[model samples]
Target: MLAKARQSLRAACDQLNIHPDVYEELKWPRETLAATLLIRMDDGSRRAFKAWRCRYNDRRGPTKGGIRFHPNVSLDEIETLAFWMTFKCAVANLPFGGGKGGVCVNTKELSQTELERLSRAYIEAFAPFVGPDRDILAPDMYTNGIVIAWMADEYSSITGQASPSALTGKPLAFGGTVGRVDATARGGYHALRHLEKSLEIDPDNSKVAIQGFGNVGYHCAKLLHADGYTIVGISDSSGGIYDEKGFDPLAVMQHKHETGSVQGAKGHGKTRNITNAELLELDCDVLVPAALERQITLENCDRIKARVILELANGPVAPTADRKLTEEGHIIIPDILANSGGVTVSHLEWVQNRSGYYWDASEVADHLKKTMERETQAIWALHNEMSLSMREAAYIHGLRRIAESVEARGTQAYFDGA
Candidate 1:
């Protein structure tokens, strides 16, 4: 994953004719920390789990990313995620670099007490490296606001300091931004809104399909549906349900909440159960892969027929598929830009924590809309002016900022002096 991420960045740099030396400093992470987390099991036995934190860069600002608790977590994956976070933050114009941390454990198997202990232990182990001005951790896969709150509390108690800014995505009572929960989806909506004029598709007339039913996917479906888009299909990990005429996203969400899946929800349109692969190929105006990385690969790029492919999931469209889709004239909204709302809101949360001021939901939403629109226009303008792919244009736009910062700081002089 790290190799692929570096390849994508390098490809973009090459298209821009960026000097290889400029990229030499950007290719590898500044630091990668691995630790063993010792937690007492519910059965009174202790187990050690491997955990990792990767700080990709700090040229722009403090590192910002999430801590994911999953069985498949590894140092390489965390580093790749941190690298993506750097670009994502840069694309969003946030004052943050990239960092990510994760523990290789399935939280579902642990009891509530055990989960808390594990969360604290993970923070305790990494406390020396993370802080408000260092690396700030948020919530990611299998981790939520509760986990973030726990981690933040642990950090504060351990350090005996008031450091709410050390983490984002905590519960609102603990300083989380009001719009953080749906920030990722909301950001995607803003990107799609900005692209509507270029795509020449009316929201009311467009049929939308989302290939994941998690927080990001469901919230995206809701926001788009409220905006008058016809949600034609929705899916989860198990499978997806499709309706040709369009489905009520709110109803589907309620059903999914009750039934734990959207597979068997009764609807007016054709209720056919389809695999995620089949759902991706459905004839829709916009297809959103909000699930996981590599969902859209070279093998399945030919099957996609959507006019606009909005990636709400991180790395949902693989590099190989990205090339194919670009060749096929698909307006692929890259994840760095499409799914940056969460981090944008995280910035808001951090600001609020630092300033002791908070905004209402409408205020937050309006602020988010303006930021997303401005950034989208910037990226779109760059793409048109340079005749480059959106992904390449975004990378060029973001990398230039980071590269300029690195140069302005005389970073190379320090090494030369050494």
Candidate 2:
């Protein structure tokens, strides 16, 4: 995945005839660390889990990204995510680079005590390389506030200082921001609002279908639905539900909360049960792939009919599908920009934590809206000025920022000399 991602990014730069040195610098991560986390289970059994942290670059500032825990976690995957984070932070104009960590373990298989021990062990192994000024970690797939709080506490205890800024996405009681829970979706909402104007999308007449009913997808559906966009379909890991007259977002959320899926939600329009793949190809004005990566590929790209594709999930569209979709006139809001809200709000949380001050939910929302709108406008302007695809424009915009930083810091010499 990391190799593929690097090739895709370099291909974009090559198409623009960017400097070879710049492309070379962007092809590899600045640092990659792999560690084995040893923990003793409650049953008196000892186990070791493979974990990795990849800091793609810090040309902008400190590295920042999420730490995920799952059975499929691998160094290549973490490197790919970290590479995306570097560009995502750049697109959002955050003073940070990209870094990501993950452990290959299913938390569900561990007892509560074992989980805590594993979290602390993972932190202990990576402590020397992570800090508020080095690499800041946040929650990612299969990792949440509880795990973040544990890691933060362990780090603080080991270092003998209360460094809340060392981590974001913590519990509110532990210096987390009030609006952090829904920041990703809310940030995407702001981007979508700007998208509506830039793309000339009619909100009232637009139909949206979201895949994945997790934190980002659920909130995106609610916000867009409240803003008068018709939410025609929604899905989870199981299946999808669709309605032509538009299903109620709130009702679907409530039903999902109760019944664990959107399949049985009460709706009047033409209803049908569909798979996630079918949901992606549905005839909707907007399609938001909020699940995992690689959902849209050449095999399925031809079936996508949406006018706009909002990638709420990381790498939801494969590189091959990117060109196909663009050729078909589908304006894809790339993941880096579309899903940057989480980190944007995480930055806000770090600010509040360091200053010992906090903002109301409305204030946070306002800041998020302004930042997202500004970034989206800049990207769109570049796209129009250069007559570039949105993806290319986004890459150029972000890569230029990072390249400028590299040049200013004289790090370009590293690539030039190499």
Candidate 3:
């Protein structure tokens, strides 16, 4: 995954005439730590889970990223995510380098007590390596606010002091900032709305199909639906539902809550159960892939009909398929820029933790709106100026910032007095 992701960096560097030393430094992670977490199960059995943490780079500031709990977690996946986070923070112009952590375990199988124990055990193993000034952790994948609270409490216990700054995404009573729950989706929404005129999209006539009904996906659907767009299709991990006449986001969500799937949700027209693959190919103006990586690949890129794709999930489109889609004139708002709101607000949470002051939801929303617009406009302008894909433009924008930081530390040319 990391190897494939590097193609974008190389292209950006080549376009910018960047120094070789910058590419050399960015190609490898600065440090990665691995450990096994042993937890006693509820039924009097003990299990061991493999885990890893990687700080890809820290030239900008302390490393920042999330810890995910999934059965497929591996060293390669963790480091690749950290690599993307490094670029993501740079693109948002946040003072953070990329870091990510995860444990190889199915969170669904664990009871609440067992989950808490595992969360704390993760901190116990990595406490010495993490700090507010070193690597700050947040929630990701199967990890949520309660899990983060447990980790923060463990960190405080280990350090013999209140250390809320060591983690973000905590519960409200602790250190979490307001407006964080929907930040990721909100960021993408702001970007898409900002470009509506340029993209020739009218919410009144546009249709949207979304894959993945998780936190980010549902919020994206709700915000867009409220703004007058027609939601024609929606799906979760299990299956999908589609109707040409559109569906109400709230109603679908309520159905999901009651049934644990979107299969029977009602739409204005004939609602029918479809596979996740079918949802991606539905006729719609906008398609949001808010699911895992590589959902759109070589085999299915030709079948996609959406003129615009808002990537709320990280690396949702594969590199090869991305090239094909771009070549075919599909406008893709890349993940580094589109899905960056979570980390942008995570940075806000870090600031509040240090200052001991929190902003209201309105204030946080305003800040997020401005930041997303500024960055999105900049990348769009770059894309037009260079006749490049949005993904390329975004990478170049971020690479410029990272290259500046790398060069500031004195490259070989400076030593040779070139």
Candidate 4:
């Protein structure tokens, strides 16, 4: 993942004519932290879990990212994720940098009590490293608002005061924003909406295949469906469901909730249960890979049938696939820009927490729509001007801002003498 991320940055840097020093700095993280978390399990035996946090770049402002809990978590993955967040924040025009944290554990195996203890234990170990003015952690995979609230509570307990601003993605009773749950998808929807006209996609007739049926994928598919787009394919970790005619996303969700996965969701006459990879290659007008990283690569890039790809997952398309997809004339809305809605609203939650004021969901949505549209336009404009791929344009847009910030500080390199 880190290699692919650096490769993407290098591609952008090559076009930007960036200084070697700046390019090197952008390729590596500022700090990567690892912790051994000892937590007492329900069985009363203490277990050690591997935890990691990476602050990639703070040239823009205090770093912000999500804390994930998964069995596959690793320092390398977290570091690369943080690197993407650094660019993701800047691409969205947010006044924050990038940070990421995660713990290695099978969250499905833990009870609620054990989960709470683990979440709080994570904060207790990293309290000094996180704050509103420092690295702020939100919810990611296998983590949610309650987990965020637990971490925030732990941070407050450690500091002897309320620290709502120390984190975002908490339950509304704590400090989470109204539109946050759907913000990631909504933001991608708004950004993707702008490309519809230029890409000549008619939502009323176009087919969209979503690779992940999680929060971001589910919401994006739902929103696109509501906006008159035909959602012909949707998938979860277990498998996917496909039909030539559109399927009701919410109904599929309901079926999945009743069963164990969407694979059981009954499809119409031309229905089939497909693997995650097969879902990506479905013949559709738009493909939204809201799943994990490296879904699109050179191995499968040639099989991608979608005219437009909305990346709601970080690093969904490998750097090698970028050139392949581009050569095939596919338009990709990079994850940094496409899935930035979550962090954008995270900033909103921070604002409301600091000011002790909250906006209605509509107000938040309006601001988000406008913000994503504006930022999307900037990258789109750049892509047109330079004939660069969407991902490269996004990196350049972010790198330029970060370069200005680094130069303004003038606390490091003296080559430019800013």
Each prediction's total of clashing residue pairs, residues at least 3 apart in sequence or on different chains, is 0, 0, 0, 0
Tens digit of per-residue lDDT, candidate 4, span 1-418: 7876788788777888776667777888998888999989999999999998888988888999999999988888999999999999998888899999999999888999999999999998888888999898999998998999989999999999998988999999897889999999998999999888888988898999999998899999889999999888999889898998878888899998999799867655577888888999999999999988889988999999998999999878887887889888999999889999999999999999999989999999999999999999999999999998898899999988887787665534574454
List candidate 3 stretches off by more than 4 Å.
none
Q: How well does candidate 3 match the true structure in TM-score terms? A: 0.99
> For residues 34-151, what per-residue lDDT tens digits would candidate 2 score against the true structure?
9999899999989999999988898898999999999988888999999999999999999999999999999879999998998899889999889988999999987889999999
**What's the CA error at residue 96 for candidate 3, in Å?**
0.4
Q: Each candidate: what lDDT?
A: 0.89, 0.89, 0.95, 0.90
Worst 10 residues of 3 by lDDT: 166-175
lDDT by residue for model 1 (58-107), tens = 98899999999989887888999999999999988899999999999988
- RMSD, one per candidate, in order: 2.1, 2.4, 0.9, 1.6
Q: Estimate each model's TM-score.
A: 0.96, 0.94, 0.99, 0.97
Per-residue lDDT of model 3, residues 110-133, tens digit only: 999999999999999999889999
**Best candidate, TM-score:** 3
Candidate no. 4 TM-score: 0.97
Cα misplacement distance, residue 215 of candidate 3 (Å): 0.7
In model 4, the Cα lDDT at residue 310 comes to 92
Tell me how candidate 4 scores on lDDT: 0.90
